[model samples]
Target chain A: MPRSATSSARPAGTAAPAHFDFDGIGTSWQIETPRELDPGTRRLVLDRVEEFDRTYSRFRADSLVTAVAERPGTHLFPPDSIGLFDLYDRLVAATDGAVDPLVGRELELLGYDASYRLRPAGAAERAAAEASGPAGWAADVERDGRRLTTERPVVIDVGAAGKGYLVDLVAELLRGRGYDEFLVDASGDLVHSGREPIRVALEHPLQPGTAIGVAEVADASLCASASNRRVWGDGLHHILDARTGSPAREVIATWVVAADTALADGLATALFFTGAHRLAETFHFSYVRMYADGRAERSRDFRGELFS
Target chain B: MNTRQKKLALATMTGLSISAALAGCATDTPSSADAETVAPSTSAAASSAASTPSPDASSDSGSADASSSTYADGDYSATGGYVSPNGPEEIDVSVTLAGDVITAVTVTPDATNPTAIQYQTQFADGIAEVVVGKDIDEISVSRVAGSSLTSGGFNEAIDAIKADAS
Candidate 1:
């Protein structure tokens, strides 16, 4: 439910934008628009979010993604998940498998399973989990029309890229409804639409209540990934490298800006391995990363001003 | 200074070792694939020079010098391969050029691994569709096989194609 609808007028020169906040997919969500959305439009946005939540959420046993785990063989894929698949396909190529979706099993074995509980698994449990799923499943996943045939029972997690993908989808829905100049912030994965650029603060990885930098964006999105938070049980956290099956240690935090929110999110994860500027020029995104040694690297043309 | 600015501006005041130096020499560096090799400033100049392709006729790192080719107007095919972490993966390319204008192109990636071949085949077919009607010198593929090794193999074949056309 929306915590509060801030329709209150602002300063004389500024436009009085409407603000919306809600919780879904286990995170806080917010929307800001220059004009208030009609009740029908609001319902449409929520319905789309719920639909995606049901289709992709592994936490829900009835969700389609969980069904992928429950069934080992080919299943008729969700009609709309094709876009998600394509985004992931491109991301895998772009990031050299750093942005893999097949990491779901790794997360589950680490006690980040459907229950959302935080407990590190024992050595035997990890070995058992490793036996159940393959580390790389994208190449094996076959998509023909509405059918997705998997060679093996793959527990792919879209969490790394799905949240940002959903954010873009919601932004598209809002734009389709003739709502211009809007901002969609889905638990810090943001897509800011509008002619006016928005200034965003980069969250410091080590220090609480501190920002590492400020970025400005117009008609684009910003996504960040850090290995510091979401910690539980002896250095285990949300971000897991498929290669190592542990938290990324090279870089502590990463921030990337891209035209698409999903792309930005995936690139941020990739930045952990490949420094922000060192990534191939093929990816047209700008980034700034804080390394484990506390050194910072920023792209030459990274879109905003450094805090200095 | 504000707390936020203080945290960010530290890159300037403190000797945080600005690692952006890799941005310059990394452009034509053949060792761009690995992320652990970014020690620069002292060794950046030496490593970058040592890694740069000599462009000598025998140099295998650089793609085929399109300029060396005598103007041709027929179909050209060449095979290129790159050794992946697993093993050697190769791709074959055929470009039908009508007086420097590409009419059609096709890529065939040959590999024993299922995923590697899949990406190579997909990229080969896709690259042909994209490069048709364009000059060979203008063909620049940023990504193809979801993996850099596959992309490298694809480029290797394209370089060989230029050599064949020449």
Candidate 2:
């Protein structure tokens, strides 16, 4: 709901809402609310974002994830991380390890490393990475509450769903500050808590500046993922399948709407490798997935319209 | 629990069973020619019908009807078949019911093809396309959910690649 004035016209008397825009976690963020955020509230929101980054960012040298990668031992995360790690646990089981957070090492080997090399590893490097890649989340890690224990070093990348979880966290911050109606947009992931539903365009993966469909989100979260977002080498992208240590090729783009942003975001990535029905068994959500061959499939209950 | 709560729970269980049955043989797999028969159960069909309550029925009368309509506590299994892009596929679905409420469900993939098996495994975890050409500008959208708009690190990577090329 934070469209520019020119894009979204307001009535004569009603003033347009204020939008707080910034960049964090390697992506753009825009928070829209009818009431402007006070300085203290804004500080709280930013601090929460920083705390999340400090805990989960694999790119940062000071992040806890980096510490975990450097040493194999028990690490205690903040209580807030309980939801995230739990969600990852469910995602691993539901996706049959295709959506594991352990895919971080696989991404680094493919040249989407911490330094953002963006270069595909050569055949020899690829073979080595594959041989020593993560041995699945269940085999390598043990999580009890906020305590995560690993037998060996593992690069834990929460890229698939961390952004959306951060959005949810920020939304909670806003609500705690008495801002009940707001929209948190972390780049493409969004959580809406307002009364009126916002119409969101589902961008086409193959065609930039164009959309394949539109989803109406109200009091829910909508998250989108595509193979085109972070492309470097031929057929390489961020959404990777841990089973093959390669980018998923079947579903090129996925849009999921759920009760919360974290689930929506994680399910969006899961849709790339797993079917929506299987996920529905564990989590209730609606989705639309576009295949590499250009055909698109949507859930019967997806609250949106697709342009053929 | 109250009669209304019981009915609501029954409806949800029935819906899940129906959805599982339908999703078992839906789309996304290569075609196959495996013909398998799932033994049909009369109780399953009757239970499904009984799960739907009459809207006008009041609680006092509904309670008695619900008590009489309770399903026999047992496990029921059925096989559902549908044709995919590859060929025909079948899924075996079993449900445990207690007091007419489904307590558990298991969908077993019965396809012989490896691809179908893979798809079935994905299905156990958890479409219409009409082509109407409309310009992006015509639709007024408050925001867009797509591939991430931009990442500073990604941009820097692009710049590094450009520098190397030059």
Candidate 3:
């Protein structure tokens, strides 16, 4: 479960932040604000989530993503999808295709299919899937504004930054409804908007209940990704280095703080394959990455404290 | 200050300690003749001394040379390159030495990609290992962001399969 606690550093006289907790998009969510949300606003948030899932979820048979998988043609996406696709494009370029969204077929071949098989395909089956799967995103898909065109079947899995984008969308909804100071936490992907900075602990990848460090985020987004979270086989995880169609072995976990949740989430995954410095060139963010060898590196500009 | 600045300050302090240690080592082997030979053209001596592959070469020379007790006094520089998972990366390392003691050290990042450059910059800035200390329970944080805890579906499927087997 995603952990949430009131900061011990809160002012003595200040009231505790109100939390609205629920489950959506297959993960737990908690929105922290100064006041409780009315029923109408809550319904709007849930509807938005349902709308996003219906469009992007590859696991759902009726989702637009499933339709894309069934056929090869130009599929229209919602206008808001521009942000998600744009981030994916930049991520693909930044990591040299190591973080491509078109790796859905590869994930399925590795037993992360729609049915949640959790069974690895045979070596030959994996090879055949790789050969038949969509070529590189650039070669396979074309985008004109919100329109996505592909000649061959492609499993458009926006799993990399979709949840973060949804968080952003929900945040926008809350803001539109006049909630200014709030923290929207979609699982571990968080977007905080308020005057006071919120201190967030960076969980240890090897140890579930312990934290490696803390980050102070105010009016920004913090996202973390770890390879151990979704493991099934001896050396299997959800984070795949698309270049090799295998789980990335270098970085075990990563945390990124950016202006937006989508970029932070995407970069968290990108950090598995690419170095933080490379990503910093194009995006303004601070990060902490833990390597498999037990070394943790954080940017100098990273806010908050890290225990040694 | 930025992380690089903090690291540089720490590196400077470490360098001072190293310098003091080397100074102590040099004093144990006070050789006037060796000092005179190295003082005038220390750069030339340092270049040749640095190129010598064997650490025991100073003892082989048979003279109580200052280079034997410590490095030759001068500025020394070297460029090192390595192939990372991303691609080949390189950096230039330069150090200033006085009386066989390193007075200063600097690393120039020569990476082509931004990621490599970032890593190189951090490396150049100097990396201090942050040992884990306080537990999560000890600190007060509003939230914790780590690995997403959403593998419930996968675990449920596994449980169902196990029940069938039983």
Candidate 4:
């Protein structure tokens, strides 16, 4: 594998990758630069995304989510999932289960089931759903070495940090294929390959076009979050709190940089609910926080290179 | 034909579109979501017009209008969620109207990871609800969870969303 300095600009002579369009994991997708990569390289990268989807997707029939939820006390390793169980174990110890995997069952009951396309539910329906489905990470799952069994038949939705990890994998594959300066951005859970830092504009969660801050990242993962972006009156939109099956509202938006995209992605979600003061001891990364009330906070470390 | 090929394509496109949209959404802020919501319905209606206009037409309009209303005044929310092909993890996000424009934001931390139970409910709502009625002009986000770095990125998005709304 060849590693080089990172640059936002595309290199000369390399064919721009082909762009592929499709849908999975409750969202539409498009791939660029597929044409540029060798056939074998392309195949491996694509396979990785599919495997993760199968293990994690609630909408899919054979997903590990369905397998685990439908069958308890069984060791089910997804043929191709993101190995989220592994990440969950890390988070459990890192944040002490502040963000648990077992909350899948409660999330489903809270009206966050797989069938939930991006449409809004009625107020009454939303209220009733929130009533019966409150869950916590404490009781749903028990894990052993590379194996996990759900204590109950709860839906496990992994729509938060999965893709970020995928980005890291694909970026790694690109390096293996001899591409040095590349960005493996899986819907903003992106990782860059190269020594030079890449400049990314941080979007204002509340205001779309305007950039509140900018960050320069080199060989690190960057992730962002925003609360006021998409929601309904019933307080139900995307980004469900597993504990309550509702949207999380602690911090408006969060951005994180870490050694890996997976950690950055998980930390982004964990920090969104964890709060800055609490984050002081738990997380080890550079960050910038924008509050719903217009107050912005940045870690002492994050301030060094992110801003001029 | 293979699922791998499709997923590869999906991942690539998703990455590209996110990059492009991030830049696009930045320039067109306020009305970007409106255009996003309206553009699809208009195209759908144009296609549907070729079909029968039945009792469902009104219903379709109602649903479209409800979602479309959200896009008005640049108070729009677009979620680009994805799950990796290697692990059982996923990311979901939505930007909503705070007060006049969009003043609130929320992020579900590792909705798949079973460890973040405590910060899920009130914290999620608190972040999102705080933006309920605020204008795009006045919005902010702080580190509220274990991952301040992540919260900072989210706050950056809120600023982008609000700037777009105006």
Interface RMSD of each: 20.6, 7.1, 11.4, 14.8
Off-target runs (Cα >4 Å) in candidate 4 are A1-24, A27-35, A79-83, A93-96, A117-138, A280-282, A303-308, B1-166
Top DockQ: which candidate number?
A: 2
**TM per candidate, chain B:** 0.34, 0.38, 0.41, 0.22
Candidate 1 C-alpha lDDT tens digits along B1-166: 0000000111121211211111111121222111112211222111211122122233332343465533244444444455555676665544443333434433445666544543343332121111012221233321110001111222444455456669
Question: Tens digit of lDDT per residue, candidate 1, span A39-130?
Answer: 88888888888988888888788887788877766787666677778877776766567667888877887777776455667899878866
lDDT string for model 4 (A171-274, tens) is 77777877775556544556755654556666666556445666667777787766654442355544555544456764677778887877777777776556
Quality of candidate 3's docking, in CAPRI categories?
incorrect
lDDT of 3 by residue, A227-262 (tens): 988887778879987877788775778888899999
lDDT of each: 0.58, 0.73, 0.72, 0.49
Top-scoring candidate (lDDT): 2
Candidate 3 regions with alpha-carbon error over 4 angstroms: A1-14, B1-130, B158-166
How much is B46 displaced in model 2, in angstroms? 30
lDDT (0-100) at residue A2 of candidate 3? 27
Estimated TM-score per prediction?
A: 0.64, 0.74, 0.76, 0.56
lDDT of 2 by residue, A1-308 (tens): 56354533444676688899887887888999887989999999889998998999999999999999999999999999999999999999999898999998889888888888888778898787667655678789898999999988898999888999999999999999999988999988999986677899888777766788899888999999988888887888888888778787766788888999999999999877765555766888887777655756676567878887
What would the per-residue lDDT of candidate 2 be over residues B53-157, giving only the tens digit for each residue? 221222232343445535444545565565666787776665544555555555566777545654564444322233333455778798987774868889889
Cα-lDDT of candidate 2: 0.73
Give, for candidate 3 chain A, the lowest lDDT window spanning 10 residues: A1-10
